[model samples]
Target chain A: MSASSERWPLRKLIFDTLFFAYGVALFADALGAMGVSAFHFTQDDFIQNFSHYATFSLLLTGVMAIVALVANLRGWTTPGDALFASPLRKLELSARPWSRSPWLWQVVIVFTLTIVVSVRVTESSIGDLLDADGLQGAWRLWSGLSQPNFNLLPRALALAAETIFIAFLSTVLAIPAAFFLAFFAAKNLMQGPLALAVYAVLRALLNLSRSIEPLIWALIFTVWVGVGPFAGMLALTVHSIASLIKYYSEIIESVSDGPIDGIRSTGANAIQTVWYAVVPQIVLPYIAMTVYRWDTNVRMATVIGLVGGGGIGTLLIQYQGQALWPEVGCIVLVIAVIVWLMDTASAYVREALK
Target chain B: MSASGSPLLNVRSLGKTYPNGTKALSDVSFSVDAGEFLVVIGLSGSGKTTLLRCLNRLVDPSYGEIDFAGRRIETLQGAEVRSVRQDMAMIFQQFNLVPRLSALTNVLTGQLAHQPTWKSLLGLHSSTEREAALEFLKLVGIADKARVRCDQLSGGQQQRVAIARALYQKPKLLLADEPVASLDPATSHSVMDYLRKANRELGITVICNLHYLSLVREYATRVIALKEGRLVFEGRPEEIDRAWFQRIYGEEARDVGIQ
Candidate 1:
């Protein structure tokens, strides 16, 4: 057989060692669980549980082994006429242009190692985690899925309105603040220590606001302003600043500096420079970003509501705590529908802007 | 408009050393008479752009006095500088029209100095000003594309539109910095033709920087050559010979200019 057809010795050795180790670990665990003593490993209750739990995993490994075997068989070649026909083997193939690439082989080795390790780690008994009592409770929960209570519809609609209001208010508030911060951050627009200081301050503020999730912001606002949509709006506004600042700054940075220089050459003051050059270039992008942020804020508003910033999630939380499964499902469905519609509308608006 | 009047622009010992300590222009002194078409030529880093920009105080000269139309521009501050800039319109290599704005809107932006800040912000231009913008657009030969966005046009057409915008400013002096560098040969010729026409018809003192010696030879009445931030040659186009160009551009001249 040709050298290419021959099995790689190191690969074969590593595969065999891993397979043996897995088998030993499974056998040891099974023996210990069955209360077996000494070196003798017996097949008993532990073996039954282990085999039942690991049936799917064992099937997967067996399929992988079969596929590898087939690949090996395909690579095999006869020795006769191999010298002239398989000239690639005789030539310095490693010196070829493509042979310099090591990333492909690295990925293959890493993937194979991960699969082997995963198979070994998950071979023990786990069926007890899904016992009859546990399964029965899950079945009961699933069976409760039916029409939601129509009586709560009014409250749901009101909360939905609150969520929309919060999102709208917050997005509007964030835009102007982000606009100034973005100009400060753009390297082409500003230079030196002042620019650096402004950038650092803006970046720190953005990170600080975003680092504390909207849920945490809602909680803090609830304590400060009392539980209402106003609290929710304040929370969304702060969070929106963080998101908009990053997006606005990126847009500012990408703007063609040509017009800016042209305007500056006209002896247009700083404010005039921004109005004439920067604003004209970034207006469309800014509008698109605002619409997208509004959509995101709408989703976040609902989430924050669960923490007492009033919205649809607050009502959903109440129903969930009372085991109103059908109502919970309905609320989830409503949220999904709203998000999908908003996403589609936002996409259309963005396309129109472009 | 008198033929023997004082020069429209005067520069004395103009020098610029950037923040990074690189000298862009040094000891540059020149003057342009009213209604003069002076073309400046130089190598890539020869500081022609810096010198032109210093006329309006765009690039603040480290040591100089720029007196344009009898006004001391080098000492002007804030509104005073803006007033001088209003009288001096600049055209760039890239055309520099706001891409998103329509050609008409871009032209109207030149009238920004004349309009109230709030009125301009609201985009409320007087009907007469709008009509004048349209007239200038027609003069530049793209009046049909008045409502079209600038990005929709070819490079040459955009540069024409930029020239029209500069005309809309009604400036006494026009500065064009490599205005035809981005265009092909035919387009470059057409743009230079429009610039020459504007200079003659409007009586605007034109100071243009050109890289192509042939274009300068064909169009400019007076040519100024700068080398290493200093004026190396200054005379009428007829006076610029092979030896004079070689002195200014060195070995690179054999590859450049009309062959």
Candidate 2:
């Protein structure tokens, strides 16, 4: 028999212990780097700031660890094993098909360790979030939501319309370019060495552009287009084009080859093949996906305004900056209503297409 | 086989070796006359499909000498090749209709080769073309389902629609690659009957691949058998006997009748 299939629980236990010790040492090193003598028992000042909560947390963790160790040594499973078992099975949640599979325990241990490491690295505390000044400010913000300045309704409505128009115009501008890019990027359509090279280049370019958020694009365009809805439209168009190409190409890629071969065998030209076969299959999905993009762009339009790309968001930022709570409340109400309307409309269109 | 005048299609020393080193067809020479319902019989991977596709230049032959209507079709390029395909309509086992489109529209797409670029793009069909499409649909016995989506139709009905589409091409030669493979025994006869009707009534030459020897016996005016990419037998359908089947299929192969 091979050594790999051998039952060596003792060796595994030793490796697991070594890994646990390494984690503890790493955590201490991090704390020490942050000027906390976390592992030094001789430090006189360390215990003063440790607090009662810290001591209780440490005691609880130590007890849990001991229980896990004892359970593992006795060849019995722990609660951690049950917690990481297949989530799909209701009655057989704790049942393991292969008792020797180590993925469950490894995942549970890694996940818990990640949470602790993240919290320590961020140096965040619950007390700072519950501070009196922060709580008071939050309360004040909530209170302003009760009374909106209805007198600014007309201006708010106009700005809301402008935001929607920005989204619509940008989506329209992006679609045709994305449509052309999709065919070139689709692996089924683009063959040969040169065409494949073009496909790769286009995919890389689209991925790079899409990886940046619309807000970042808006900021860059605001600098170029001089702070207006034009900047917002341009920014949204660029981001929408990159993202829609990916979606459109995926649809094109997965399209059934039956119709394509049917059209091709008819001696239909390349353009005719796409128009007759490819276009029919993709039309409904393209419309539904583009409508979805338009809905997302409506939401993005408001956010872009904070960067001076113009819309209801610009008014929102202005009123909120001056602490004119009533005007800010009015803009927020108008934006919410319009966004809700767009969402409902797009959802209806998508459902109808399906 | 008398040494008569020139045949409509003459193929000599045809061969196809795929890039993956699979020899799909080798030294396959055959002649097809006009208005003949020729059936190709073979097991899977015996180059029947490849031979049919190569007839319309769907799969380019690595080396071949093909003369269609006294023209050296093997050396034709671009528009000339496309024009040759326009005259040779091909149908598939899967009934490759654009599933989303109405059966009538899928049939209308067969006229794409004859239409102008602008008209085809605009999906503009003349009243006469529309009438002709419906007539073909009626001929296939699916005129009532012409307005229905092709995907919603049964396998037999979809194959009829495919036949209707091929009729719209007004092709001189029809190549069918296992057109009834997906249908039941009765439905298979029904679809094959339509092809036989087209060949007899419209004077269209058909070369089709058939899996069932019984179907070949019933429908084929002339029959050819292939084994391991080589043409093993060629004669009238009634000439293929148990010894011939053994030679074509292999020693261990048993003849399975469909009916």
Best by DockQ: 2
Off by over 4 Å in 2: A1-112, B1-4, B17-22, B74-76, B246-256
Task: Specify the CAPRI tier of model 2.
Answer: medium
Write down the worst ten-residue block by lDDT for model 1 chain B.
Answer: B250-259
Off by over 4 Å in 1: A1-158, A176-204, B1-6, B255-259
Error of 2 at B48 (Å): 2.4
Instruction: Tally clashing residue pairs in candidate 2.
Output: 0
Q: Which structure among the candidates has the greatest TM-score?
A: 2
Residue B174, candidate 2: C-alpha displacement in angstroms: 0.8
lDDT of 1 by residue, B156-256 (tens): 98999899988888889999999988998889988888898899998888999998888888889899889889888889987878888788889666635
Candidate RMSDs in Å, in order, are 11.8, 8.2
| Candidate with the greatest lDDT versus the true structure | 2
- lDDT score, candidate 2, position B42: 87
Consecutive 10-residue window with the lowest summed lDDT within model 2 chain B: B1-10
Per-residue alpha-carbon lDDT of model 2 for B1-259, expressed as tens digits? 2135878788899999999999999999999998789999888999999998787887889898988766788878777887888888989999889989999999999988877878899999888988999999999999999889988999999999999998889888899999999999999999999999999999999999999898999999999888888998999999998899889888998877887
TM-score (C-alpha, index-matched) for candidate 2: 0.80
